[model samples]
Target: MTSSDLCATLDESDALRLLRGGQFQLEGRLVDASNTTLRARLTLDGVTARCVYKPVRGERPLWDFPDGTLAGREVSAYLVSQATGWGLVPPTVLRDGPLGPGACQLWIDEPDDAEALVGFVPSDQLPPRWFPVAGARDEDGTAYALAHADDPRLAALAVLDAVINNADRKGGHVLRGPDDRVYGVDHGVSFHVEEKLRTVLWGWAGRPLPAEAVEVLRRLAGAVAGPLGAELAEHLTTAEIAELAGRVDRLVEQGRFPLPPQDWPAMPWPPI
Candidate 1:
């Protein structure tokens, strides 16, 4: 659907309301609407937030070269976020259109005024051997400080990605929430083949998955047939749901201490 059509689908009332007057208050620019994702920000009320507004464009891309449809990606992101709520993703606030972007979302506030590191790396710098990317990390040296290890949080995030088939878990996408609550973002490029995981956090590789992490996945499994299951069905096909459910079961069978798959890449390159 076109951008305007999305607004009607969400039922957001027309007539824009003014909040502030400056750039933060004015229309937000398109942040990262790429082959897999689209984002925009605008000041609706008094608060300023960012939104990665993705819509279902109906039907998946037939070509293997990889072109993502907005709607499917969005629905998958929302369902996974809702199903795996442990601060692993941003919530799909609302589905409206004709605002700043074609879609309206619960704007994700930046790390509570803690801006990203001096230089947060992007995902493109991943190992050229894994894929072909030259001159990726052109600017080197302390551009950004990396997240510390021993932060039990990244372990949980790794588990989440494994279950969701999220190939793109860039380091920068993982957020340090209030009270050391770690969160993961940008799941639009998830649940596809190519084992797309490109995260930079693997300090705990081969580590036994924690009990709490397993429980979370198990809980998600239980909900798949009920709340979570129903929620996902709207966006994905029945077969996809089955696959997701099956994956969760595999994690549960590991009994909270499954070792990281050795075959998996050590970490996402460029270390984003």
Candidate 2:
């Protein structure tokens, strides 16, 4: 089946099974990525899908994060997204690939006419209902702004980033899936015990949490205290998991979106 057909047909369980058990045939690599990110086709049980595979052996160590643990953190981010019931993340699993055990995530295909929910817009011509997070200039001195839509889907993702402490939420990492869902990818730098929330989706900064997000957080709190926390322990360190729980509690109590960190860079480098 084609990639679109596979994405339309597979439920969460099927996607997880295919990712965990399918054979990977590397097709190419994302050269721009900081670590090794391979594009490959995965097949199992007569089903085929395109996926991105990041092998643990190919990880580039960062001074802040422990070496070789990026893949597990990617899986942990997915788990948190799932627990929130928002499904902002694509289905991801930590499994052995051609290179070694690492994160295998379903690749989302964008429709030909899909509208971008995040991007650079002319400084004085921001779209309606969009919020500008920062300003910039082209090489010739044309002004632009880094912005995102006032979209609830993107807002939920912003909350997920907060929960995961996502350190790199560049605009390219946010996708508008053909399945009509907003998905976030490239989460290897998330779930740090420190507060490192960075993203272009700061459209709702300091605003009251949407009622829907508050309700989801309530359900998530219970899950984090029970089975969900247990499952996360497989991919995250004990301290990291505890911090995740703490972030959730603080969000629920505060009932507002967080402001950008003053000590850390508020956005990722090359914000796009």
Candidate 3:
């Protein structure tokens, strides 16, 4: 389905109900190095939707994150994104599925030909509009450049990552949908209480947040201290929820994209 069709047909309540109550037919296990993710079709009340299901039982234990908590983090990311008014994440919910209790996220139907504009470019020959994310070196000791699109949506996504403390924002997580809008997915590792904001979307690092994005951040700041805070507490630790609110407050107060923290790894490994 086109992006518009997906947006128009899927209501948030319906998606939540289907994810929570529908019978999920597992299509297959999606190949990934870190976690066991399944592509499935959920049918409810004679209606069906394609979704990605991450069963808690299949989660690979991580050193830093609590065991079996990735699914909750995924839902929290969705809620935070929705609260921010960008809907950066697709509809997702925590539910019992074919494998076990887990996260069921609506799949984005991006066109096959569409791709994220991520890669290494020469420092001196950077493309117009595209901005450098980081500088690197090849085996020959030559300069390697990392970059991403200058689109506003991508910029907004960077802000979303910051607010959620998304630890893994690989290039593959960004999608160009059939309707030509960019959609972000795979938010299993986010909202950590600590400062872990690894991503490849530093194109606007150290720049002022766009006006609309700043406005969204302001709204998010207000929501996080009220209803949004209560909702997120359901899935995350009290400390994590407070930290999430603090992140939003800081961003709205600063009004600019932040530079990477000095001690933490600025970008995720395999920086696609």
Candidate 4:
């Protein structure tokens, strides 16, 4: 999508107009950042925060991401995270349209200072070190996956993201919250529900499936026949939903962690 694709044409509330600039001053630590967006620790109105700011550039959108202004992308991520509870995203500080058709979104926090794996996620960050690569480990020899996996809410997020075809659920995008829970960040790329299932989650490739993981998939399959499936249908087509269901079934039947499908050319850097 391009800047031209963005404008006050959608049936959004007046907030769309006020989304082009800042509503209040922001001050905080430069916790961590990336080439496209910067996150800082911030506080406002007696609340603590993590701020994310994206500066628009060029005649074309830099990342082949949706041609939304900063505010549009942030708002979309926040709303989707809230709806799905996968927590793989950032919060919305504010959004408003700008001179002509520009806009921006202010993010209040960042769980870590690392960028999401762009392409060919290195070996060190793969599972058990995060998959395909090695880095960190726990006593049972697992690479310390999301702490929220035990929570039904978090599991729902994984399932929903899979259903939505989230293309960037990499290690860095999942943040470790202060409560020691997990949060997902950087959701600008999501909701396609195609064969874009590239991920580092299969580091244990070829290993027998864990019983616990099986439970999560089962619960998701059950939900798919109900509210989850119904809701997904609103944003995606019947074919997309079937494809998503197929993915889950594949994981279950394989009965073992699968390896990254490096068959296609790697997703382009910047993915734009």
Candidate 5:
């Protein structure tokens, strides 16, 4: 089936089943990825969809994160997203692929005319409801500002990034799915025990948390204290899971969005 067909017919549970049990065939490599990432087709019980597969053996070692753990972190991000009921992440699962065990996530196809929610805009012409996070200069000396929309969907993702300690939420990582949902991808560098939150979605920093977000956090607190925490333990360390819980509680208590970190760079390099 085509991606649109799959999106129309399959719900989250069906997508999860296909990701966990489907056969993967590598169609190509995403060369721009820092680690090996394969674009492939997943098939099971005559249902087929495109998926991105990142094999554990192909993961590159990072200085802060443990080696061979990125794939699991990707899955963990999905779980947290699922728990939020925000559906900000595509369905993802850790399963055996052609190369070995890895993360298999249902691919989201963006529409051709989908406007970017996070990107560079002319320095002096910030769009209404858009917030600027940083400034930059082009090779020709033109000025630009890194920014993102004030939309609540993007706000939900920003909160998710904070809880996951996502250290690499580049602009390119945000996609507007054909269904019009805001989805975040490339979460392999997340869930570190350290305070490594970095992203392009700092527009809502220091603002009051949206009421919807507060309700989600309340549910998330319970989930973390119960079954969701157990599911995460399979992919994250005990310390990391504890830290995740702590972050959520603090957000609930503070009742506001987190500010950019003072020690770490507030945004990831190559913001787009």
Candidate 6:
């Protein structure tokens, strides 16, 4: 099936069940990752799809997050994205794979006309509707700006990062879909109980959220203590779930894009 057709036919629950029960064949290693990740084909009940698999044993431990929890955090990010009704995250689930228990996320294929993956562009050469994230002067004295395509979908992704406390949202993780929608991926470093948000979407800093985004935030604020909260509790610490609720409340109240933190670089290292 085409990517859009699969997306249209499979709902989140259907995708999750497939990830948990489908036969997965390891296709290759995604060698660019900091930790181990595999590309695989998942087939079940006459449906076939591609997924990225990250096993717990392959996870590199971080000082801030507990060991072997990155996969669960990825699943949690999917849940938050779905609960917000934006469906910003591609379908994801936690399951046992060839390597071990891991995260299986739907793979997004990029189109030919997609925005350049190399995010560093000279300030004067940005495409229409793109916005500069930050600028720097190269050692050779050339000026370039880190930028992202400006779209309402990206704006929604920024809000999603805020609520999930995503600590790493680099340019390459933002997939430009064939449908012209943007999907955020690689959310393993997220939902910490602390203020550890890091992203390149700071272009929206301090701007009032659109009414629709704010409304989603408001709905999330109330839902967190209900089913959403229950689902997240299965993967996150109780304190982390509480913090997520607090973040939702604060974002709904502020109704504006958050600025970068003073103590940490706003963007992740290797911005793309």
Against the hidden true structure, what lDDT does model 6 obtain? 0.88
Instruction: Give lDDT: candidate 5, residue 100.
Output: 91
lDDT of 2 at 24: 84
TM-scores for candidates 1 onward, in order: 0.63, 0.98, 0.91, 0.49, 0.98, 0.94
* Total clashing pairs in model 2: 0
Please report, as a residue range, the 10-residue window in candidate 1 with the lowest summed lDDT: 14-23
Full-model lDDT for every candidate: 0.51, 0.91, 0.84, 0.43, 0.92, 0.88
Error of 2 at 194 (Å): 1.1
Candidate numbers sorted by TM-score from highest down: 2, 5, 6, 3, 1, 4
lDDT of 3 by residue, 133-196 (tens): 7899888888978888798889888999999999999887887755576778888789888899
Worst 10 residues of 5 by lDDT: 1-10
lDDT of 1 at 235: 55
List the candidate 4 regions with Cα displacement exceeding 4 Å. 1-48, 51-164, 266-272
Clashing pairs in 3: none
Q: Report the lDDT tens digits of candidate 1 across residue range 1-272.
A: 32222322322222122111212322444444343234455444343344455443422364422443334544566566556666555445335443332223433334456534212334443322222111233355323333434456666677777776765666567665433445676565556543444455544555567777777777788888788778776656676678778777877786543333467654455456
RMSD of candidate 5 to true structure, Å: 0.9
lDDT value, candidate 3, whole model: 0.84
Which model is ahead, 1 or 3, in terms of TM-score? 3
lDDT of 6 by residue, 1-272 (tens): 75456655677788777788889989999999998999998898888888999999999989999998999999999999999898889889999899889999988888887766338888789878787889988889889999876778889999999999999999889987666667899999999988998998888899999999989898898789899889988899999999999998888888899988999778898888
Q: Residue 64 in model 4: shift from native, Å?
A: 9.0
Model 3 poorest 10 in a row by lDDT? 1-10
Best by lDDT: 5
